[model samples]
Each structure stands twice: as C-alpha cells, then as structure tokens.
Target: MSNVVVQPTGITAADVLAVARGTAKVVLDPATVAAMATSRAIVDRIEAAGRPVYGVSTGFGALANTFVAPERRAELQHALIRSHAAGVGAPMPREVVRAMMLLRVRSLALGRSGVRPLLAEALVDLLNHDVTPWVPEHGSLGASGDLAPLAHCALVLLGEGWVLGPAGERVPAAEALRGAGLTPVALAAKEGLALINGTDGMLGMLLLAIHDAAHLFTMADVTAALAIEAMLGSERPFLPELHAIRPHPGQAVSAANIHRLLQHSAVMDSHRDDLAHAVQDAYSMRCAPQVAGAARDTLAFVEQVAARELVSVVDNPVVLPDGRVESTGNFHGAPLGFAADFLAIAAAEVGAIAERRVDRLLDVTRSRDLPAFLSPDAGVNSGLMIAQYTAAGIVAENRRLAAPASVDSLPTSGMQEDHVSMGWAATRKLRTVLDNLTSLLAVELLAAVRGLQLRAPLTPSPAGRAAVAALRDAAGEPGPDVFLAPVMEAAREVVRDPALRTAIEREVGTLG
Candidate 1:
C-alpha cells in the first residue's frame, strides 16, 4: 500500500474507511519508524534517570502522586491494562474494532506518544491479519480518550484479552495471535497509557457516520425530487437564482441537486401553465433544500473536525523534541462530542422533514388527486398507510436520540476526571440516527415513486424516471398492497445502493 514512501501526516479519511471496512493494508513509513524510535529513546532516558513522569513513572489519574518502585513499573502497566479492561456491554462490531485499532496505530505512528515502533507494528500486524480484539459497547466516558474501550484493545497486545474468530466467534487473544504468528508486546515506559489515551474509538465512529450521512443526505435530495414531482409541486423554488440571494453553500448545493433532478419533468411542466394549481407547495416540498442543506453544512463541519482528529496526537504527557515530557489535556473528547451531537440534531431534522413529505404523499387530502395512501383501490387496500407510521416511529426515536450526548456529562475516575465528553455515546446514537434516516428515506422513496407512477401516462422527468425505474426493478411496480415490510426493506437497499446514484447521474448528470 506504500506509494513511493508513506507518511503518517497525509493519511486520508478514505484511508481510514478502507482499513475499517475492507481488507486494505497499512504500510508505515520507514522515517516514521525511525521517528518512533527517537521518541522511545526519550521515554527510555526518563525511565533510566528515575524522573517522576505522570505516565512513565507515577500512578494514574486520582493516584497520580503515588510513585511506583522500579520493580513494580512493569506490573503498573500490566495492571493498568487488566483493571481498565472492564467494559461490560456487548462486544463492538468487528469493523468498529478494526477502525479503532487502525486509528490508534496512526496516533502512535505520529511518534509523539513515546511508544516503541514494535508496538505500532504489532497493531498493524493484527489489522493486516484481521485479529480484531473484542471491545465492548459500554464504558467510555469519552474522557481520558475512550479509556475502557482502548484498554480492551490494548489487552490483546499483551496477550491477555479475547479476539473475534474469523467466523465471529470469541477466541482467546493469545491463541489468535499464535495462529497469526505474532507475539504479544511487552508494555514499556508510558506505553500502556499511550495505548489507551486517544479518541480513536469515537473518532472512528464519527468518520463512519459522516461517510454514511453523505450518501443518505444525497439520497434525501433524490427522494425529495421524486416527492415533488409526485405531489405536482413546482420546481421553481429550487431555482439557483432564488438560492443565490440567501447564499448558504449547502443550500446552493442541495438546491442545485434537486433542480438537476427535476429537469425536463412532464409532471412539473404539466402544472407550469395550469392556473388551477396552488401558487406554492407546502414547506416540506418547497424547503427541502434549506433543511437538507443545513444538514449538509453540518456534516461538513463534522468532517472538518474528523479531519483534524485523524491527524491529532491525543495522548497525555506527550513526548517533545527537546526531551521534555509534559502532561497535557489533549486527550479530551469535547470537540468530537460536540461535533457528533450537532450532526445528530441535523440528521434528525432531515429525517423529520422527509417523514412529513412521506405523510403528505400518503394522505388523500394532501396527495392532490393520487389515490389514498397511493393504493390502487383505496378502501380495499390500506396501502402504505402503516408504512408512514413506521417512518413516523423512526422519526420520533431519532428526535429522542438527537438529544445532545455531549451536554450530558458525568464525573469519573474519582473526580480526577471531573469533566467528560459523552462523545462515544454521541457517536453511537448518531449511527442509529443515520440508520433510522435511511429507513425513513426509503419509505419516502416508495411513496414518491408510487405517486409518480400513479401520475401515470403523465410520466416523471428523465432523472425522476431513472430513480423510479431503478427502484421498481428492485421492489417491483407499486399496486394493490402486498406485504410492505419486504418492499420497504428493498427500498432501503435501493437507497443504499451506489448504483442508484449512478443511474440517476446517468440521466441527469452528476448531482451536487
């Protein structure tokens, strides 16, 4: 995976995603290895000189003032790993564990954490061989850098934890390492603290969430376009000139996307000259860009935070070039916590608005002349009536999950860590929000396409036609109500498919 020479500083979010989700390999720069050695030399010097460093010599957190004797130093590191590996919920997913491991390796590769190059290599080796450590879902206060979760990971490095087997079974870490032909690393001065002290877990989740949200947000725009045509709403509201006056970059991008999708629509043109239609549509259809655009802009902010975090060296008592090791509060997760919480709010609002559009598409009173709930026979079939309830239920859950986790902090580590960032919780709930949004958008896609299909002989635009046809190919043409769960799930799969985006782009050029 090395191109010419690999540098730790230029690693991308895509790189993180690759390592997290696929079989991508990591190649450390030789210079980075050399730099890590230099950093380790500083730690070695401090250990030899018998100086009382926070991580290298003295006890941790509330026990910071208690210094361990030389004989107990190694034991100090081991006990740290064992005691902190106290996470008690279900094990995290393999991908999340992989991402956390890769990110932790990236932090150490930066050479500021004073860990041996061998330790970083061991983590890389585990990643390349897929020896994912079993990390649990609970226990990170999001302070002191996702301590419990990282400790569970670090435990594998010491040959004392469990790893997920190839078939997703739990196996002993020692046995897994042996099967992979690797040895457990001995924790040295400052190494244990270095291993566990970073926001990699939460940061990894945030990065993955942002990646998914980008797709969902774009799909939201696509479904919104389909809904507008289905509702016989005017596309004039998405005019670039209208958005230019109140120029929000995300708004412009979303407006441009919807505008592109609505190009040459027979349904839109059918009503363009008709005096019988309402002058403007409801806010859900008219303000699609504003809501989704704000979410896009929020996602951009979260991306910025993730970008900065991807390269950050987040260990406390970090090594400096001039041979000074000083304690710093760099490990706090407040920034990521706030970013994740903000994104949750934005995602919830997007789902909320999309839910409204789905409801309008199903309501006889609101769907213009479309059949009630878009059923072929309104009274004989309940149609997508319950599907709207499903969307509404998800929206309600998202609203509750949207309550900011960052603002709900609690003290831990005996008040030594009095302030904490509930970042892990924020990122965890953000994942659920995105997942629910996917289903909500799927429901909208089903309703919108059904509405467009009923507009029948009138036909959707070229882009809208492509979206409708692509989904119909998967879920079948809408008609009398059949079992909708299977159809709804299929719609979600279509929404998730990259090919759906490709198909839409083939018809309407590239969307913003």
Candidate 2:
C-alpha cells in the first residue's frame, strides 16, 4: 500500500503519490495545526481592528487595487470563487483532482493563507468522503497560482460545481459538501488568494507523472534487454568499470539496469563467437545505456525539484509569526515548469530508442532468427509494422512537446504578471508524453513478448520470461491481429504493474 507522511509542516511528493494510488492517508502534522491557529489569530486581530488588508478588504488579480465594501467583503469572497471558476476543457482525471484537493487544502493549512481551521478541516472531510471537485484541465496561467482550476476546487466549499459523492455518484457540490457534513468556507484575509494561488494542480499532476516516468525508465531497460539479447548485442558497454571512469549517475543507473536484465542469459554467449550478424548493430542497441542514462540523469534532476518543492510552503503572503506580512515569489512555478519540460525530453528519448528496437524486432533483415514482423505471414499480415508506425508518430508528437514551455513566457497582469512560466503547460505536456511513451513501450512490449512467445516453452532471460508471462497471462498470446488497441493498453498495464517489474528484477538482479 502507498502512504504519505504529513509531518508537522511537511508534505512529500511521495505522500501525494501514495494517496493517489490508494495506498495511504493524509493528516495534518500537529505543528501545522498550531501554525494555522497562529495565522488565524493574526488574521482575526487584523480584521477586528478594521485595518484594510489585501484580500480581506480588496479585489484580486486585475482588480487588485479596487476595494471591497466592508459589509460586502464576505459576499465578494464567495463571488470570487464562482466568477473565477470559469475553467473550460475536459475535466481532469479523478486522481489528479483528488491530488489537487489535498494539495490546495494542505497549502492553506500552513496558516499563511488565513483560512479558518474549519475550512481546512472541511477540505480534509471532502477528500476523506471521496468527493472530488470536477476541475477542468485547461485555463491556468501558471501564475497567480493555478487560479481558474483551483476555483473549481474551492467551488465545492461554496456548494457549487460538481462532485464525486461517496456513493460514486456525480452530484451538486452543495449536496456533496452537505452530505459529507461539511460547510462552505468563508475566505478571510488572503484566504481567497491562498486557496487559488500556488502550483498545486500542475505540481500534483507533474509529481505523479514524474514518479511514473521514473518507473517507465526502468521498464525501458527491461524491454531493451530483450531486444539486446535477441539481436546478439554486446553487453560490454554496460560494464560498471566503463561507467566508473566517466561517473554520470544516470548513465551508471541505466548500465546497472541492463546488467540486471542480462544476468543468466545464453543469447549474449554467441555475440563474441558468431563473427557478427550485422557487425556492431544500431546505436539504439549499442548505445542504449548511454542514451537512456542521459534520460535517467534528467529524471534525477526533476525528482530533486519535486522532492524539494512538495514540502515547501508554496502559497503566498506567507505568514510570519511576528505579525509582518511579506509578499514574495513563492507562488512562481518556473522551477517545476522547467523540470516538467526537461523530463518530457528524457521520457521522449526513452520512447524514441524503444521504438527503434521495435523496428529492429519487426525487420527480418535486422531481427536475427526471427520471422519477419515477428509473425508467420509477414507480407500478408503486416503484423507489427503499423505498431512501429504508431510509435513513430507518438515520438514525433513528443518531440514537438519537448520544446520547453518555461523558456517562452507571455507577459500578463498588465505587465504586472509578466514573466510567466507556463509551467502548467510543461507539466501537462509531460503527462501526455508519459501516456505516449507508455503505449510506445507497450507496442514494443507486445512485439518483444510476441517474439518471446515464439521462443515459448524454450525460455526468455530468467527475468524476461517472467515479464513476458505476466503480460501473456493478462493479455494472452497475440494469436491474430484482432483488436490490438486494447491489447496495447493492457500490455501497458502489465508494464506499469510494480510486482511484475520486481519479479523480473529479483530474477535478473540489478542492471549494471
């Protein structure tokens, strides 16, 4: 089971992933609760003194300088949530929405947002009841936080918008909130900004995408091992001694992963004695560790960013216990925005090489001892030909998306909101790359496993065979080209399953 440790004031990306995977729970650290109390006391004192504050007595965003009539301030707060809930696009996946909810609530819990403990508690209640706000995917500037999207999240507190009720029924926000015995929260000073500002929505999704992409990196190694041994590719490139002299961690990790896959394999035995099938084979095979290691390095950098940020108090007008309000740039997402784009490039390369190997697996001229297309009929069936085509297309699309969204920024907020990161765009693209790469690897997994199927009853690498068996059990042998789309998706599920991967690793040992 997955779980997250909510320390007195810390939230980890792993914690979010655990809750996302249905393996754990989230609770406030006792210290965070105290911080909330302290901040709320400061806010109450300020409001009681009738001193005009930013969010408490003023408008937000474009209307920042406009003052809200004191008598109508509460009404303005409610209206802000409703008016800003203008997001349009397909609704985000339920898991992402759940993550957004937790992130937003946790951000507010730091007490810096000036929301009442009851408000934070209600968010917890909503999440516990499994009532997630149906937030739209588009409409974030990646600045002033993820305003429009989070407005959808805050809508649940207002008894507006749609929610996934405990019974799994989609119901009105009011019904879901009331049924859960939670009340709408009234935003206090900076509460509205705190509720909506920050990179929670994008960060949550990117964090999960990043974690999964890391797993995909390993899967790429396992699948690549099959292509290597089948093609009689040399394993000398992965020797630990080779990497030790250069000393790149990602390169080392990729080399290690391959070593794990090739352990106990007979296919590599003939590579030296056979006098060469096609000389040295393609760079994708010979340089798999090197190319893929660069990707691992990129992932490592991205992980560092997420690991550092998830526990940070990202929402702004961050509270100071001494009653000083210092506005800062904590809300900016340039760091994560750039990280998202970087990892997409890494993931794309991971897919790009896997696609090359799939091409190799399908070509009779290249795939030693294997039938054309890994199918008996070859010319008549076309077997895995189009699968390679599909992979190529997805890889190209990934290339286009890999252009950093963080590098290009459009000025907003009348130049006040200038220097936008568009980090949300980067994170969103990273997610798409993840999906694309999953299917790309799946196609290869299908072709490789199919190749392994022919060797059936013969044997695969101790680890490779088990990996193939797990897919075969779940997806069955690819007898005839029926509906392959489902098979591709199913194969992806097998690749994503951690247990199958662990079994392969245990049998094969470490890569390098």
- List, residue by residue over 1-512, the lDDT tens digit for candidate 2: 44454554667776786676584656766677777888878877777777666776777766768877767877887888888898887777878887887887668766676667667666777767777888877878788778888888888877789876555556788877777777777665566666787988888888889888888888888888777776667777778898898888888888888876776765555455666446666888878888788988888888888887767777766666788565667788898898998899889888999999999988888887778887766666767778788999998998998888888888876787877778888898899999888888888778877876665455567866786777775557645555567777788887777876877767766443
Error of 2 at 128 (Å): 0.6
TM-score of each: 0.98, 0.93
Instruction: Give the per-residue Cα lDDT of candidate 2 at 128.
Output: 72
Score residue 18 of candidate 1 by CA lDDT: 86
| Regions more than 4 Å wrong, model 1 | 1-6
Sliding window of 10 residues with minimal summed lDDT for model 1 = 1-10
Q: Could you give me the TM-score of model 1 versus the true structure?
A: 0.98
Query: Where does model 2 exceed 4 Å of error?
Result: 1-5, 165-170, 277-279, 453-458, 473-483, 510-512
- Report the lDDT tens digits of candidate 1 across residue range 17-69: 88888678887898889888999999999999997999889999999999988
> Each candidate's lDDT (Cα)?
0.89, 0.77
